[model samples]
Target: MLVPMPSEPSGQTPPASSLPGPSLPTPLPAIAALPAYVPGARGDAAVPPIKLSSNESPDGPLPSVTAALADAGGLIHRYPDMAASELTARIAAHIGREPAHVVAGAGSVAVLAHLLQAYAGEGDEVLFAWRSFEAYPILTRIAGATPVTVPLTADARHDVEAMAAAVTDRTRVAMLCSPNNPTGPALTTAEFEAFMAAVPTRVLVILDEAYLEYVTDPDVVDGPAALDRHPNLVLLRTFSKAYGLASLRVGYAVGPEALIAPVRACVTPFSVSGPAQSAAIASLEAGDELVERAHTVVAERERVLAALRADGWSIPDSQGNFVWLAVGEDTGALVAHLGGQQPSILVRPFAGEGVRVTVGSPRENDALLAALARWQGRTG
Candidate 1:
């Protein structure tokens, strides 16, 4: 049986009572308007691709760590140590700091988030360079703090002088991501010292060295070296980049116990799992064998730079395990063109025409070169 209603309703709007539950919270227009985040493409059968979109180590986790993961299989039944004390002790010893001075988290990101939550609050300003790490601003806003963004220089390097000038009395945190994401240029020791000197001590400065291992520059600021001079300087490093433990999600910070203590309180209990802890510890013990990979990536990065330059592509001085290809206005077309290649290499393309190509194994590097060469030939 069919019940028919009038094709043209007898002239009235539905009563307000007919609406579903309460209306959504009055959203922050800025946040509500933000576009959805897009992760890099994965195994798309239609697109034969090599996913280099994220700045991940092309060489996977160390062999010893893999063995540790397998050995830790049975232990998954039990919860990870809530304190993560053993992993903290091991990491602290490796970094030449006391365990109390170290705080491990899911990744360096969790440490950064906790730091923001502990320090910056409503009406506080959090400063960072534009396009440094996208998460900085998002985290700041999430913590009810104002984000003070400073533009990078023409070469895409952090203009430390400009960043220092942007600081205000309300500024609670300042972050510097050296060998910065996307651009890959790091801050010189002198630049960091100057930036620190210019900044007031009340405000904390976090130097994110996520890609520290891939850097070969002698001038780059060593995390431990600056620890003594600046009490507020917190250096954040991760095992994800060179050690290839991204899946394990283990990272720690080296800083004054005052700051570290509050940040630690913000961390959720047992955030880092037992297998991750075992794998991270194993990776740290492996040491030099793991670090040697950085050297290989650096060499490959140079080759990629030269080949791109020869092909008339403008690239930046990448100190990380990745290189940046800036195609200016043609970003979309360029990405589509490059992504369309056979045994295709995918890259992290930014909103504007900047793409980051992670350094891969020798064979993978050669494949990327071939693709870039073909793209250049067609686009030039």
Candidate 2:
């Protein structure tokens, strides 16, 4: 009755296998079903690689943004503005919206997640196009809501009519990703307006314009301009892509004050760091310079697309800062071949779907074209 637990031998600890394991709680069943969001591969560090992955700006953050970040560095000990007041005001001013109608989050993804959390839950459904942003279904499931997806058209564009037809009584949110990821064609204004007419007013519509800055197409849906007409509409914009603040993570949503209030409530307190807010405000101030840089990327995108088409690749008309190559089952082989090169080229591959190549600097773009030429030769 008084026996003590046996002690370990001198200078030796008991085997980890013999220890009593900690009990852990089980996760939601839906979590296991969720697919992982695979980011683009980062090539080896020994050699400098031509990285055209992640749709990031070839030229990093703007000069003004960098300067603001440097100035904000001294405030590292302090917590960020919980309301993100200054940045919110700047965004509202930039978009000609009221401050009360705007809410800022770490990034557009975070803002979108908050929106889902606020409006969707068990028994509700969130709708979006298939093969759009990979995060859509993941975030929808995380909110304990059912994800209803409509397939993209054969041209790799949003089948708006199909998406609108798929909406049901359970549908609480519908997301439209203009200039959709991996498949770069944007949703036209007429297509969007027709879809909006078909959808019920109760269902919230989110227009994700993350690549709006790089869009050269005149007919693409302009989210902010249409916000006045669709009270249920929410416009999502990010500083990550065109503003080149991917590392800092700042994005905003503009919508009706009533809906925005709930989205703001769902955001984690002080999640938007001080430096990020400062950089975003600085980025807003440098609007002209940002526009110039975006134009540069758009020009390069056209050049790359033209070259690819001339080389027998049937690419969609991309309005975003990237191009999509529908390589079908050859995705893995093409990705490997590109990565296996001396100065490897990194592009986002969607297994059996296609590859997304970011518009890089002139030299980097040339390198990518050269790599494609070599691959074509080998495959033929």
Candidate 3:
């Protein structure tokens, strides 16, 4: 009874695996069925390869944003503003909305999750187009709701009529991603208006415009105008995609005060850091500089898109920061080959569907095009 204990060596830590712990609880059944959200491939430290995977800006943050980040670093000991009050005000002024109607989260995706948690629950149906944003179904199920998906058209566009018709009494929310991710064709104003007319206002409609800055098409849905006419309409926007702030998540939603109030309640307290808020506010001040960078990326995207088309590839007219290749069965092979190139180009692939190539800088894009040519030479 008086035996001495075996102690860990001084100045060394015992491995966590060696410790005995209480019985862990099992996760909900839904966790087993959730599809993993695979991130874009990253390069190893040995070789900093060309990165064209994520839909990130090919450029870095603005000078003003960097300055803000440096200044905010000194305040790490303090908690961030839970309400993000100043950020809300700036977003409202930029988008011409009242501060009460705007809410900020770590990212737009987070904002969407908060909306779902507030309005959706077991037995409630959340609807969206198939093969759109990868997080749609995962988020829906996580909210303890069912996901109702309508297939995209043959040409890779939302079948809005089918989606509107699929709405049922149990439907609580519907999402529309403009310049739809991984496929990239923005919804026209007319298409959106018609869809809205058919759906009941009792159901919430989220129009995700994460790629708004990269959109050059004039006929795309007028988001602000739509929000004014539809009480249930809310827009999800992000600073990650084109604002060059992917490292610091900063996104917002704009809608009527009635819906925004509840969504704000669902957010995790102090979810956004002080540095993130600083960068976003500074980004707003440098709107002119942001547009210049967007223009550069848009030009490169057009050039890459043109080259792909000229070489006999059929791709969607992507208005977003990336382009999609609907290579159905050839996805795995193409991605594998691209990853093996001299400098190694990494792109996002949705196995068995196609690949999504971010529009990198001209030099990076050139590397991608060359690798594609090599792949075709061996296979074609």
Candidate 4:
């Protein structure tokens, strides 16, 4: 029998627990408590759907990357390089780091999982700011570590001081998502330096810079440059964003050799496919085109943010390629208005908290802006 669930005020979602409880051999409590991942909503409209739900680049793989993927596809029978040595070397060279400092994985999310597996365990505390990456707490729980979170500052940025202060003997990993997801404000250079200073060196710090390529601000924490000083700090980056290879699932980490070694060891065998590796390398070689595309995304993001703020939405300063709308209880209403429109605009909604709208092509964004205008008319 299905479990009884308390109704949500928005009336747009059924509680996750409303589904039938798991039977047979019982799952672990942490696993049981973990919220099911809610993917960006997809619309079944006859017309093409504007999928700005995930923070994916609107652009596709560059011709070079596509050719590389095609070549690698012919060699699918052979296993991928488990060490991903060539890819690692390319990333290291790009960041002026040695190969020992890098580890390649399926995606940054996979790399994070491996990092947690290597460093955290039962009774340990994994710390991060609330409303950050959805995967942070999930991965912590999966590693049997307790997830601890400090609320985001009013401006929707990390309270690094609070995070550092919250650390205790049991804290194993502390994650900082610059240009934090869902709500989009990055840690400034001074904020990051202060955080690193306040936190103990014994605890590992992960700076997930998945959206790094789109950041136009000159003062966001330069994570790669800070690596030498903070040996405990690791940078997680991906081809999935600016390089436009989301389907390939290629990402990597650069960090101190000691912390990276165990994370490398914990990754699943041959998880990153040959095509993904080839595509990632090719994407790196096509860095110029990627940068141009990233610039366009940033420009559109600024335009969108300006329009939203002019509309009096109270959005934060988003350094990422997406913007956040803290719509609160009206989240469902906003989502419904957008989704119900012709051509159907879909996005990522965090229940009653907010909506994350990825900066898409000019036309798609225009549709989004129009939808919001209509929503405002209906509500206002």
Candidate 5:
């Protein structure tokens, strides 16, 4: 015997009553309430839009990666290798960790979700800075966990001390996005070390270095160096940014075997596609030739920053491939205003008007600069 479920657009679950009811449990309220992710805009409709949105590699994937993808064409008819053994091994060697300590996922973001799902749930708390990565809170909520958002300091860098203070016995994880997305600032090694020391051993600490390649700061935390000392520390990196493999969707995690294994269990088998695995391997082999592109992006990012500052915009100290324009206005207005100009440009604008612009080729960068100059004239 079963109770009937109402078939409305906003279906209401049957209330407890004197009559017998269906045993099916209702879906978690948190899961139902999560918002859909809004990806950055693209295509010609955008005006003066030099899309510096979504911190992707401006140069695109490597030639070897394209060749590997071609080689994998025949293999696509069959399911990909479930383990992604070769890619995992190459990633382990690349990160100087044992293969058992690494896990490959469809993307770094997917792995981050897996980590949260594996470790967090109702009654558990996940802590991170408010403006770190937009995905952090979404993933935390999706995992049925409470999100403890500590606002970033005035300059828009993670206030490590504040984040550390927010942790409680109920906290299962603390996530830090270095060279943090949108803001483009990174945590120094000493600051991170001290912060880690303050956090309890039970809580997992995630250092997401998706933009590690573009980092030129000598004081940046070395992901591997902290791994041995802090078994709870997990480092996530991606080929999407500097290696120019965003479309391929491959990223990896390096952590203790305990943490790595559970997250691996949650991943649906063969989530990483055949072409993605092949391309990642090829990119790893290419080494510095693939990584050296960061130099160009870093150099160009500075040039972009200089131009923005000269025009009287407040720009943050960005070590990533993108620059953050801290305009204390509505980002939608700024984005729309920029969208009406020629050789259009697009940027990722957030809640309070912080816009992130990617460092593109010289020509694309010049286009953005011209638009900014015009925008300054109008606003002045």
Candidate 6:
């Protein structure tokens, strides 16, 4: 015979012996203090807005990728491969790295979270430039680690030297976002090497190259090529931007086996859905065409930059698929003005700092330029 759980009498308490224990469950204190990650705003559904907020490619996924997705659609009933083995292998081949050194996740952000979990813990410090990827601090805090931020240069580039100096005994992870988000200039190879030399080997450094494919600058540090020279370095890249697979959510990391093994261990099982893996494999197969598309985006970015400068906007030298306006106090007003235009435009704004405008279709770019011209006239 099994013993029964005691129940209290209706509207009355039984003796203390008959009472159950308190059932309230509390979350981690760090979680309560965590800052929410705010994504870029989506426009009105009734009338579609030109979305240049998320830095997504103007062109949709490649033809091969679309066909692959359609083929994979039938397999949704089955669970994704827990290891994401084939995707990992393809990414390794593309980068010329061993399969053991590569790990794929739902997105580069997810892979980054895994890195934080593997290397950071209570009392450890994770360091990066301020106004970089907003997710950095959030992921650090979620891992029960402290986030330390150094200010970016006035020109909106990462102060690599300052970031290196900021690392201390407690610093377990340091992040570098090349073609830094919301700000466009990438870290030059010389600067990156100098920073790496200053950092202790024990401290892991992540080079986030989410927008790297969009970069046309010759001076930018090539993360994969630098990996072998610095065992502590982890290179992160994504399929969302250049491959035009934002909806699929597949990204990868390359580093030494020791570092990568732990990150792989921390990944949630089957987080990289089956369709995502299949699409990524197909995207890799269509690599040359994708590169050509990326070059087109870079070309458009240059055209937009030239136009903005001609219009008297003092923007940074953007190397990614977006331009950053150091709008400062005008951020809210500028964003609102753009949204209020005949065909509203959506952009990513970092309150009081700047606005990031993705390079879109030629017509969309022209619309954005017109809106900016109107705003400038009005404000002047």
**Candidate whose lDDT is highest:** 3
Q: Is candidate 3 or candidate 4 better by lDDT?
A: 3
Q: Is candidate 1 or candidate 4 better by lDDT?
A: 4
lDDT of 4 at 263: 90
lDDT of 6 at 243: 90
Candidate models: Cα lDDT each: 0.85, 0.92, 0.93, 0.90, 0.85, 0.92
The weakest ten consecutive residues by lDDT in model 6 span 1-10
TM-score leader: 2
Model 6, 1-380: lDDT tens digits are 56676665689767786666667898889998888898877888899999999999999877888899999999999998999999899999999989999999999999999999999999999999988989999999999899999999998999988998899999999999998997998999998999999999999999999998888788899888899799999999999999988888898899999999999999999999999999999999998999899998888999999999999999988888999999899999999999998789999999998899999999999999999999889998
Clashes per candidate, residues 3 or more apart or on different chains = 0, 0, 0, 1, 11, 0
Pairs that clash in candidate 6:
none
The count of residue-pair clashes in candidate 1 stands at 0
Worst 10 residues of 5 by lDDT: 43-52
Question: Relative to the unseen true structure, what is the C-alpha lDDT of residue 25 in candidate 6, on a scale of 0 to 100?
Answer: 91
lDDT of 5 by residue, 1-380 (tens): 56575564566555568446558887778877887776777846633446677777777677887889899987889888888999999999988889999988878999999999899999999999978788888999998899999998888899999999999989999998898887888989988998999999899999999999888889988889989899899999887888888887888889999889998898878989998899889988998887578888899999999988988988878989998877767677778776776656778777575778888889889988888788788888
Q: Over the stretch 1-380, how does candidate 1's per-residue lDDT look in tens digits?
A: 56554354578766567644557688886466544555566658885578788778878777888899999988999999887899899988988888999999999988899899899989999999988777787788878888999988888889999999999999999999999887889999999999999999999999999998888889999888799889998989888889888878988888989879999999989999999999988988999988788888888889888888887877778889888887767778778876777776788788675777888878888888888787777766
Query: Which 10-residue window of candidate 2 scores lowest in summed lDDT?
Result: 1-10
TM-score of each: 0.91, 0.96, 0.94, 0.93, 0.91, 0.93
Clashing pairs in 2: none
For all predictions, the C-alpha RMSD in Å is: 4.6, 1.9, 3.9, 8.3, 5.4, 3.9
Better of 1 and 3 by lDDT: 3
- Give the per-residue lDDT of model 3 (tens digit) for 194-311: 8999999999999999999999999999899999899999999999988999999999999999999999999999998999999999999999999999999999999999998888
Q: What is the Å distance of residue 336 in model 2 from its true position?
A: 0.8
